[model samples]
Target: MTGIFQANRALLFFLTLAVLIALSSVVVVDENEQVVIERLGQPVRVINRFNPTGASGAGVVLKLPFIEQAVHLGRGLKGYSAGAQKVRSADGQDLLVDTDVTYRIIDPVRLVARLGSTAKLDAELASALPAMLGARLGPLSAAAIALPGNGGAAQLLRGDLDARARDLGVQVIDLRIGRVMPGETALQMTYEIMQARHLREVDAISAEQIASARQTRAQVAAQAAAILQDSAGKDPEFYDFFRAMRSYTYVFENPDAKNPPTIVIPPNSSYLRHFNGQ
Candidate 1:
C-alpha cells in the first residue's frame, strides 16, 4: 500500500510541474492587439503584428519562460485629437483649428522600436499637432483657414499628417476638421478686405466693357460714314435723290425727330424733284 501511494504522489507532482511550465511558455494573443517579446529590455520579436497582405498572427505563441516579456499594443483603430491649435494664415491672420485623426498600427516592429507602447505614442501625437498644422495652414489664406468648410486646407492638412505619421509606424486612415474659428475683429477685417478686392475686380471688368462698347459704336459710325461717302462719289444725282427721300421719310415717320422745321416750298422744288419727277 505504501509503494502504491508513493508512486501515485510522484506522478501527480510531475504532471502539475509540466502544466506550470507549459502555461509559462505559452501566451494567447488576440485579434485586436499585437504582442512584442522583449528580452532584457530589448525587443526580440513580435506576434500578431499588423499585416496588410498576409495572415494574422493572433493565436498561441511560444516564448521562453522567465526570460522574455510580452508588451501588448492595440492593433485596432485609435483616434487622436489634436484639439484646437493656433496657426497663422498666409496673410498673417491668426486662426484656431481643431482636427482629429484616426490611425492603426501597420508595422508593430517599428512601433516597438520607437515608442514601445500606445500610451507613449498618444502623448507624442498630442505634441506633434501644432507643428503639423502650422506648417500646412500657415501659408494658406485667411478665409480658407478660418472657414470651416475649406477643402483646400483640409487636403493640405491631410498630406501633412500623412507625412508626419510615416515614422510612427501607423497609417492615417481618416482626418477630420472639427472647427476653424478666427477672432471676431479679424474676421470682420478680413471680410472687408476681401469685399474691397472683389469690388475692384468688378469695377475693372465694367470699365473694360464700357470701353469696348464705345469702341464698337465708333467703328459702326465710321463704317456708315464711309458707305455714304462712297455712294455720293459714285452717283452724285442719285445720292442727292436718296438724301432727299431719307429726309422726307424721317420728317413724316420719325415720331421723335428733334425740332423738325416747317416746310413752305413749291411742289417742283429741288428737294421735291425726286417725288415730282420734274
Candidate 2:
C-alpha cells in the first residue's frame, strides 16, 4: 500500500509538469494577429488568419516550451508618423515636410529575420523613409510640393517609398504628406512677394477707381452744361437775370474773400434794376 501511494504521487507530479509545459507551448493567435514562432532565436513559422491552422481562424500553434518563442505582430494595418523632416526642393528651397506611412507586415518570416522586433523595424524605417522621401522630393520644385491641388509629387514619393520598403518585408499601403512649409528665408520671401502682389493689385484698383471718378465728373459736367445751355436757349432774358443774381450772391456772400470789389454801374443799368425795384 505504501509503494502504491508513492507511485501515485509521482504520477501526479509528472502530470502537473506536463500540463505546465503544454500550456506554455500552446499559442492562441487572434484573428487580427500573426505569430512568428522562433526556435532558438531563429524564426520557423508564421501563423495568421491567412495561413489558418485551426478551425476558428484563431491559429493555435505549438512550439517547444523552453527552446522556442512566439512573437505576436498585428496583421492589421499599422500607421507610423515619420514626423517633420527638412528636405530641399529642386528650386533650391528648403522645406519642412511632415509625413506618415501606413504599412503591413507582408512577410512575417522575412520581417522577423531582418528586423527582429517592431521597435527595430520602426528605427530602420525612421532612418530609411526620410532618405527615400528626400530622394524623391529633390527633383520637385517647391511650388510642386506646396501647391494645393497637385498630388503628383506626393504620389511619386509614395511609389518610390513603397518600392524600397518592400525589401524590409513591409507593404506600404499609403503615404501621406501632412504639411509642407518653406524654411524661414523662403517663407519670408513668399510673404514679401505676396505683399508686393497685393499692393500692386490695390494700386491698380485705386487707379481704376480714380479714372472712373474722373469720367463720372466729366459726364456730370457735360450734363450740367447741356442743361444750362438748354435753359439759356429757352429764355435768354431769364438766363441773364439768373446769372446776374448768382454773381451778386457770390460777391456779397463770399466768406473767404478778404476784400469786396466795388463795381461802378449807371443808376439806370439793367443789373441794378432788380435791386431798385424797377
Candidate 3:
C-alpha cells in the first residue's frame, strides 16, 4: 500500500508539470499581422504575423517560454488614418469631400512609436488628411477645385496628399474623392445658365430654319414670274396669237349664238378681203 501511494503521488505531480508546460509554451500569430516579441522590455524576436503559411521568407518562429511577449504590427494595406472633411473654394463654394487613403507598414518601429497601433494610425490619418486637403484646397477657386489642375483634380489631389503625408510614417499611396456635390445657390445658378444656353441654341436653330424656308419660297415665286416675263419679251406676236386663239375657242364653240364673245375686227381683215377678191 505504501508503494502504491508513492506511485500515485509521482503520477499526479508529473501530470501537473505537463499541464503547466503546455499552458506556458503556446503562442498565436494572426494571418494579417506581425509580432515583435520583447524580453524584459527589449525586442528579442520579430515575428511576421501576416500570413503564417503564405510564403517561406520567414518561417513560423518560436521563442523561450515566459521570457517574452509579442507586439502585433500590420502586414498588408491598412485603412486610412483620416476622416472626411468639408472645404470651401475660392469662390466661397462649400464642398464635402470623402477621401480614402491607401498605405502599408513601412517602418514598424517609427509607426509603433508614433501611432502605437494600426487603428491609431488610421484615426490620425483620418483627422489629419482632411485638414491637409482643406488647407491646400482653401486658396483654390471653385473651378480649380472642381477641375483641379491641368493634369486633373485627382492628380493634383494625389500630389498634394503625397506631399502632406510624407512625415506621417505611412505613405499615402492613393486618395479617392468619394463624393462631390454643389451647394444650393451654385446649383441653381448652374441650372439657369444651362437653360439659357439651351434656349439660345433652340432660337438659333429655329431662326435658321425659318430663313431657309422663306428664301426657298421667294426663289420659286421669282422663278415663275421671270419665266412669264421672258416669254412675253421674246415673242410678242406669239403672245397675241395665243390670246386670239383662246378667244376664238370660246366664241366659235356656239356659232350664231346671241351674246357671243364680240371680238372687234379691224377694217383690213385678211379673211374678209380674200372672200371679196378685192
List the global CA lDDT of all models: 0.81, 0.81, 0.66
Please say which candidate is ahead in lDDT: 2 or 3.
2
What TM-score goes with each of the models?
0.56, 0.59, 0.52
Model 1, TM vs. native: 0.56
Ranking by TM-score: 2, 1, 3
> What residue runs in model 1 are displaced by over 4 Å at the alpha carbon?
1-21, 146-151, 183-278
lDDT of 2 by residue, 22-59 (tens): 99889988888888889999988778733334433466
> What clash count goes with each model?
0, 0, 10
- Tens digits of per-residue lDDT for model 1, 148-253: 6564666666767766777988778877778777856678998999999999999999999999999999999999889889999998987888788888877777
Candidate 3 lDDT over 209-229, as tens digits, reads 999999999999899778757
Candidate 3 TM-score versus the reference: 0.52
Off by over 4 Å in 2: 1-16, 49-56, 148-151, 187-278
Ranking by lDDT: 1, 2, 3
